[model samples]
Target: MRFFALVAASVMLLAVAAAAAEYNVVDYGARPGGRADDSAEAFLAAWAAACNDSSSPVMRVPAGTFLVSQAYFKGPCRSAAGVVLAVDGVVVAPSAVDSSAWIMFHYAHGLKIRGGTLDGNGHAYWACKSKTTPGRRCPHGTTTLDISQSRGVSVRRLTLVNSKNAHMAIFDCTDVTLRGVKMLAPRDSPNTDGVHVQLSTDVRILSATIRTGDDCVSLGPGTSDVVIRNIKCGPGHGISIGSLGGEAGEAPVRNVTVEAAELTGTQNGLRIKTWGKPHPGLVESVTFAGVTMRGVQNPIVFDQSYCPGRGNVNCPGKSSGVKISDVKFTDIQGTSATPVAVRFDCSSTNPCTGIMLNNVNLTYNGKQAKSFCKNAHVRLLPRVAPRRATAYRPALPCQLESRPEIRLVGLRLPVLCLPVLRLPVLCSCYACPSRASPSARDRAGDPTAGPAPPSRSPHLLVYTHMLVIYFQDILGCGKFKKLGLQNEEALQKCFGDIISVGNDHWSPHMVHGAAAASPSNAPNVDGNDTQDIDIDLTQDKATCEEGDTNEVEQISPVNANGKRPPRPAPPKAKKQKSGTALTIQEAVTSMATSATSYASTKQGKYSIDEVMEHVIACGATYETNEHFIASELFVKKEQREMFMTFRNNEVRFSWLTRKYMAKYGN
Candidate 1:
């Protein structure tokens, strides 16, 4: 019995020794700076022994250059903590890659890999140009590191360079954290994306510096809850949300945030692209904030009609139906190399909505930034893309600057609750002259009833109009000139140019006779102030009526007495419920939807004065001359009355704006 007990004790000691083993690759016959296949076999042996150990085993590779062929470390380890691979050496791939990944780990959990230099030796493969031709169909050179079907994985402080394809590909992973990693490749290298994530969740990549030809970080299908912060990307495609929906059975991507990134000399700063074909999944709740760009081609973009293949050039596929919404861009300041700093070419079939641009200031060639928007509903928040037209800033929700307690509601059109006022108010209004109430002008008396006063500055009004005209051309309004105008055409063009112009059709200025029609005689025109015109919603739809001649022209010509005609009586106001009366801003709240909802509705066809009326009624103030130039709404109350003094009152945007007025008006 004593002999049997002694034998059992010996066996227990041996098991404990195996559990606590630390297998160094050098001791396992891995020769540093040796042949590829041999070194790989040695690494495999070390990993196999370490993975079987009962305790948390560690495999170490000391400093040296080790040539390793296509290798994989698989896990379902006996140890609770799995394995820790500490590599201080330089790992080199052979001149020709033999497999899809130079170093791969599969089905691993509780795995940690730290401190290593992965040299892909990609120059040799680039010379041979594998996968460069049609006949070479196979995936040529392998990605530097590939981790598949892994969880609880962490890779820290690794330097990877010259990858044949992507530097790292993480697939089907969760709870993955990569920190302080650096990746580099030639700026022109093809397909060498820095870190690619697909079908992954709960992934965090922080403090990464990537300089590559492709996207610094590319999120593929089924990636969600991913955060990428404090990244520096240059000489590459900055960060991309997809090339999604290429296939029929792809998944959705959501809840991705990219913050504090600096992108310099890159093709794109922040982009989301999908195939032009119909994609069923959605891409939503993606936010890109606090990004700085220098010399970037397209700082912010969304391209749903992406078709890059040669065959697709002529066909360009169909409109992509990937439901993309609730995307916000905040504090993205930069200088763009191209004039088109922002291009939102969304799919017509699934028009993008709930898009917000907040405090995004981008410039091109020392000029204010330019944007081309199509088929998308976007809210230009306060201080958005401040360029040549600074007026866009004041049009945003007033609460953003003054009232902190007020919260904004609605994504396409921002509505906010004012602390001083209880009801919600729309933030975006041109705050132009048309919004001035007819009663307000009537109380001030007529400017044309007497000779022009010495204090009244018609010259300032003319200069302001000229400035507004100049800005219209700068803001993609070339089509306005092509519209043929006759008498009072110049004034008609000025008053309606900001709004009421169709995409191609132009509105002619309303003039009684040919006297005030010419652009040169603009200063002598009867209506120089925008508020002089009362916006009458009850008028006939057409600008001209059959020979009534009494139909008030937009700018009525001066009579032989040098006096202007009286404006028609305005509609009566509805009585409010017994209590506090609603302010004019609260009454005209719906104008926010009509004026700012440029995505679905074409508000440009509404008269500038009409849109301005709603904006002004909404409590937005045209406090500066620059504001007047941008909105075509003079700030001075007297000036506004002067501009509208000689015209008929027609509310062009009333079809939509009046609905809100009826609901909220006092």
Candidate 2:
């Protein structure tokens, strides 16, 4: 029995030794000289040797910044099926090289490059490219990290700085996982994108901090099943779907999801780009959910305008012809630059269809964003509302200051909220002259009315009108030219231009036959503001409507009045309610939904006091008290949990909802 015990103890020691994986740990400290001064190719060579030797163990480099012009990670890097090539030391490389990249991993699988820093020291490369002329190949356009044709590879917690082209590239690879990675390039740096993925599949990028001059993550054709979550992006061309197949792009990109990402100060939050040179295949099934943005330009943009400034002919499929379909954008809340937060540009003929947008909240600068589309069918759950118009910052350094121009056509209108007024209204009246424009001789006094101080020559009643693009002058009439309200002909002309008059049969803006007959509500022969005009709901159903427009016209011509009413501070209701018990205001709060519940909260009684009080009072705690006991409440397990869940979103997303509240359809 004693002999058996000794043998068992020996077996235990051997098992422990086998479980602990380690490298051979060979030392390759080079003496500072011609071949070794700036090169650590020898150390890499040693590491490779150790990895290949069945007997040699894991190889590691000591603390040092090893300079390498171009390092090729070729061969079967035997990282045992699931092991990693963990680097703790810094690897320095020339920012640009003639042929290869600083660190290139080719045909390797199941690899992980983490826990290290890579520097592309490119001072010489930058200088060499600057003093050259046009048509010359620049030298500073090399990649920092390059991986191609590998599967199940991951790069996490890695910092890549000052790269020449795209900092990191995952090419023709599958299952590329990038997490906690930081990619940086100065704001003015040229062609320096954070990470560019090409011809890859099942790529997952999460919790990455990126600031770059170009696209943060350019999905260059041949990428699908890509999932990006929890990304912080600034000063870059926010996450993109394509620069797709230039010469030979990959197959169609499908099944993409981006969630819980913040894109502050980005160019485009969610974008779908097509290749200029036409290729086959399509991009479909893309979704952007729970994304937050701040001051980003064109938060949702589908840019088919591939006109290059350098005199390239506009080509649909000839240059690059690709169509995108089956896209969904849900729960996107934030502020954008352009009024049209959600803009879609599709083919004039075979335009995109079936776009589903739900719970999208967007504000522009401080105003309501314009939601618009062309040649596409978009279904927004709640009507797109506008808060106000605000200022926007331009990208690509504008030579002239200008506001973006917006055009709307062929839109499937969403439902709008309308307020109900009390019928028993007290009547108030204002006196006005009969003539819109009095003769020059009549301006002399109302001789018959007798010494009435010339009756003030007919007060003109210059009130501002949002539709028909009308502006107001103090003389009780509009500034006709600026407001586009000069005359009946002008009003007709403006109507014709704003809405496509050519498609009069299909167009919603055409005036009814009654406008020419009743003429009372319509503008007079001379372009003048008509009083007591009723908004033709049928005519204005697809657009914004003014309270007094008798005929169909552009809804409200929004203008930014000074000193906007301060948004009501979030109610300090310490009540902890979950998802199930959301306030009606919170549920149907979209501007497009017509905010009827605004006046629900009342004095002496709660707005929802009677309706919700009994349920909440009996089931759960409505008021929040730090010392409140959870066990005291006898509500159902599911109901209590649901209330808590909803309440949490309201508080956390308070700022976000406020930003996007006004920009529903805009």
Candidate 3:
């Protein structure tokens, strides 16, 4: 009987509490001609007074343009169950008296600013310049809307427009959501980023349309668990991450996701900006899925020199000693400005890792694809491109602008004309230029054609849904000659050869010493050749004397697995061959182009017997002239001859030689 009574009492109390939790509606104007000013400040004050009162109703801003200067939401903003600040009205700033911002929210929880237009009324201040750091009493109409130091806040279906400064500045807030918000700024408006989210966590920005002067969205340091999804961005600096130089020793940005966005006419598509060297702050574990881009310049970019003010002598951007790691980009197809489709600049001291790309396909307007990361593990699924960039500058728009952000390759808008190259052509707008750029000739010229294929250049920025992506090309400083390729060829192969995963079996060998030539690459061809060799490697240095040759001899032509490696050269026989008279690279290239392709030639009619006789005859000739290897090594003559004769086809001969060599001491 006691338990039953207790349960009944508890149930009754809960029911009463639920019933008492109801919405209150506070209407500003009830008295005729006593209309309440619908300014942002006025609404905020009225809303605050009523929000805490248990008897206070949900404040409603009626459908009128209320001129508001600045309004702050300082309370906990714990909605009274069914109560919401429903603004089916327009809140405009005052016409004359300076206003800092239209709306500001701080230290609030469980709040939603929905269905409202916060207009800066900015015919007054869009063109005025603002410094990187504003003074204490900033001029009126500077920051349009700033929400800082808040949590569990949701601002949806709002149109925020025409601010002199940033359209929306969100700082140090967590668990915030911005859905269906349209942020609009002028194409040339200075410093007017659509949304700048800094040092925030667990934030979701979805289905927003932003056209701004600066980045559509700038994700600054210490941002974590952020998701920017399904957005339309154009006429902006695209999406940006980490101009990071100021904040070191802070928790880095991590676990960010950008997905399903369409972008056009933006300065870039995907970008990751760091300073010279890297900072202690890191950017890791980011993803870009299902992003479509059109007519964006330098769709990919990474600028390390973040803060280069007027007299920045050390302009390559400071290396903050930070590492960018474990990033992925998938399903991004678009038009980009430069030859580099994807470029990454991890500090050589603290390099990045775990970069993967599966089903990566991109088509451009005949510009080189400078895609791939240096000194990192990059996995590229099999690529199917009909054409490749044979050269870079003649194909890309690299250095056309004088941007302060060094370590970033700057691309210019509206290419003039591409001077007969192998890649796509586009009007560039990205700024990814080196500090020591000599001439503007690096900027590619315009060409009349459908957007060409992506270039093979391994160093340019890439963007997707407002996320910076590319470990594909960790391109910074490198000696092309040491890599066994000319500048352009090295750039292409540098992107093509990186391993595609973590430091696993397929990863590149990381050494303080130089990298070795890969067997999979094409042979060394003449730089001035009409037909290219398939190999991608830097040129080997000259062997001066016996000492050099001895050192070279110690290094065998085999990988770690000890596979039968392709000989770089046949030491003695090739010297006497007709090819020896030409340059070494020409000889190698001639051999490569002459090799049989699957489609070009037919299977031989000769049988196994004929091949056996040929092998025997070659062995006898080698034995007569050579002292090192003999006929015995050719496979036990009679058994090899008998077995090889009848099975002279390539497969049969190959298997017999392998089987004989395994059994005998050949």
Taking the candidates one at a time, how many backbone clashes does each contain? 17, 49, 89
TM-scores, one per candidate: 0.58, 0.54, 0.53
**What is candidate 1's local distance difference test score?**
0.63
Q: Write the per-residue lDDT of candidate 1 for residues 1-666, one digit (tens) a residue.
A: 999999999999878775457788988888886554358888989999988987878888889988887677876677878789888998888867754467877667888888989988888666555345654433354678887667899989999999876788787678999999999999877667899887789999999999997789988777899999999999898899887765445668999999999999988889898778875768999999999999998888787877653456522456886878999998888798876677777886887888887777788788655565556656654442223232222111121111112122221211121110111112221111111122212212432232212221223322344224221211112332333222235433322312211111001111011011122422334566454766775465444444456766587778989898878876787876543345555556767766677632432233446445634443333762223332532333322432232212211111112212111110
Point out where model 2 deviates above 4 Å. 1-26, 30-36, 53-57, 123-137, 248-250, 276-278, 307-309, 314-320, 383-666
Candidate ranking under TM-score, highest first, comes to 1, 2, 3
Error of 3 at 294 (Å): 0.8
Q: Per-residue error at 26 for model 3, in Å?
A: 8.6
Q: How would you encode candidate 2's per-residue C-alpha lDDT over 61-111 as one tens digit per residue?
A: 445566666766554456555335566666676545653246776555666
In Å, residue 414's CA in model 3 sits off its true spot by: 37
Which number leads on TM-score? 1
Q: How would you encode candidate 3's per-residue C-alpha lDDT over 87-144 as one tens digit per residue?
A: 7766666543343344665555566777878666565554333334454333443556
Model 3's lDDT to the true fold?
A: 0.53
Please report, in order, the local distance difference test score of every candidate based on alpha carbons: 0.63, 0.52, 0.53
Model 1 TM-score on a 0 to 1 scale: 0.58
